[model samples]
Target chain A: MTVPISYYVVLSGLIFLIGLVGVLTRRNIIIILLSIELMLNATNINFVAFSAYLGNLSGQVFVFFALTVAAAEVAVGLAIIIALYRHTPSINVDDFRLLKW
Target chain B: MDSLIFFYFAGIILVTATLVVALRNPIYSALSLLVMFFHVAGLYVTLHAEFLAAIQIIVYAGAILVLYLFVVMLLNVKREERIHRQSLVAVLLGATLLTEAALLVFQSKGPVFPDATSSGSAGEVTGNTESIGQVLYSTYLFPFEVASLILLVAMVGAVILSKKGLLDQKS
Candidate 1:
């Protein structure tokens, strides 16, 4: 009754692509951050799927580390976004032009 | 039966993920992200990584999504100010990635360890959590500690980055 591994891979791939599209197209920094989370979730699914199919626990362990890092990433990213919004009054990606020289 | 359940969850995940990206309102996008997280957790359950599933629900669905909602509210973004300017480029890049993934999937025979069912040596451990903990605390202990340090640094960095008047006061 187990699902084939290919199905899981395909699903993760599609999700990754969707997230990529969101990251590239969305102007809102917050939405772009959300897209990055989606991409990370897709990766987590891949890790869990491989772990389950291989009967290995290491992949799941890696997932734990990834989740931790993701949380940290979001915290810092949001803080920076808020800071940028405070400075520029906008969260649009194009509005972030301070670095442009 | 299992495949059916997996597809159902995966379908919902994909749909909601799309909604998270496509919706104009950030609040709607956050809500759809919440749905996506739950569906992903369901996928984790199907994978027999129940501990990861629970962690996913707690950390991702509960904490992470709530954080997103809070930011959305705090920012008070009325609506997306403009249409996506790079839609064409995004679609092209996404297509390239999808094609690469498809090729990899079709070319590979199957699971990397075809004969592997379970590592079986973990008999004393009751569940996936115990098995992972065994390795995490032993061989992976250094990296685990390092991860904690990274989190601490990130926390401090975030506070410094977000705090107002501190830099001005110092200067």
Candidate 2:
């Protein structure tokens, strides 16, 4: 028998929680972005698992779109990082408090 | 056998995912993330999504990760000495969420989903890739085009954002 659906859900939830903690605790901007990727992948896992269990192609299609968005997000996010790094010597999140009141 | 393979992949995935977060060096973290991505693709394969597995490797591992590495090298970032000041709070929050999710999963009744093998539907007749293409090009045609548009916009934005003094010149 295939693995149970709940197992996948639990796995996804764990990954997502790890990502959340990373995003919250990490100082490096790149690592934060990587954490965001972790979160996205967790959701994608959930989508694919549901799709497979339900015997539907729509979930895979949704994943395809999610991948597309993720690619776009990475490109733009890195570009922003590059711009920010050029302006500041350090890549630490605390260094960019220009917006902070 | 199936559950064994699932556990194997799941174990590796969790470990590497933790490494991605716990590692101090950015390069080490990225490398661990790469490992996690591969195992995720393996998980997809086990779930009968061969096409997504391939796409996962090509897009996530091949493209996105290289971009991260490029920026990391370009920036030449030093290892961060301190985590966020509120890290303790973050850890507590994560622990709460994890406990809640675990309790929810364990409390659920067995086999809430339909059996894929018993259905014996169109997915079995045609290959995974073919069926996905059919649905993507037909039902998701508009969204497909929109995704391409998003890519185009992101490309342009990246180019503009990275260009020296581009925005400054305008202002």
Candidate 3:
């Protein structure tokens, strides 16, 4: 049996939801960053799937940009995580209370 | 033909992704995330995004996941830490969440993801490298350049912050 375009869309939504839950519930900073990447990848999957099914290349091009952005995000995110770890020796999200200032 | 492979890989991707987030050990979670990336790259194959697929594996699975794992190990976070909520209620809630996602995928109509644009007409489309390259270099060039600049700024800022952090601790 062949799958249609709708399947891809729904799968993208499912994966995205899973990623959202991770972002919402996880306390570890690294895990949260990973979840954010997962969310970004889910968006990329949607863009590419649409590009493929609609016979449009826009989504693929967007994926290219998204990939580059994700790389930058990880670099900066990891750097911040390292800094936090150094200060507190913990990477949990709840440990970041100094933000209220 | 493609749907079969897409479903297979998406299944693995979702499962591994769960393990990545749900697993108690940070290093194991990072490894499971690597598996998830591999499965996602497989999905890109089914989408005929060969270029994106290659980059996904090389950049994500190869470089990114390794770096994450290194950080995970480097942090030396304990395997049996009580930082994460380990209650039974949390476990049940997480399980139900996964089940809902599983049901959504199973009942959905087409491949794992679709654009859902509702384009009423049916005809040949422009889904290829040449066309994307044209649009990207032309219409999307401004945002593209801006993105690169933003990345450069972030890189420099990170280095500066880490250096400052070290300096501050020296006293």
On lDDT, the candidate that comes out on top is 2
Model 3: residues >4 Å from true position, as ranges? B79-128, B164-171
TM-score of 1: 0.89
Candidate 3 lDDT over residue span B1-171, tens digit each: 666687798888789878867887778888888888888888877776777788889988887778788788889877343445555777788789879868976786544433434443331334445666788889999988998898898789678766646635653
TM-score of candidate 2 versus the correct structure, residues matched by position? 0.93
iRMSD in angstroms, per model = 2.5, 1.8, 3.8
DockQ of each: 0.61, 0.71, 0.46
Candidate 2 residue-wise lDDT, B49-129, digit = tens: 999999999999999999999888888878575655777787688679778876986787878667666654754622289
Q: Specify the highest-TM-score model's number.
A: 2
lDDT for model 1 comes to: 0.83
TM-score of each: 0.89, 0.93, 0.81
Query: Where is model 2 more than 4 Å wrong at Cα?
Result: B117-120, B123-127, B166-171
- Which consecutive 10 residues in model 3 chain A have the weakest lDDT in total? A1-10
lDDT of 1 by residue, B62-145 (tens): 888898889989999774565656667856886797788678768876466563345555422322677788978987899899
Highest DockQ scorer? 2
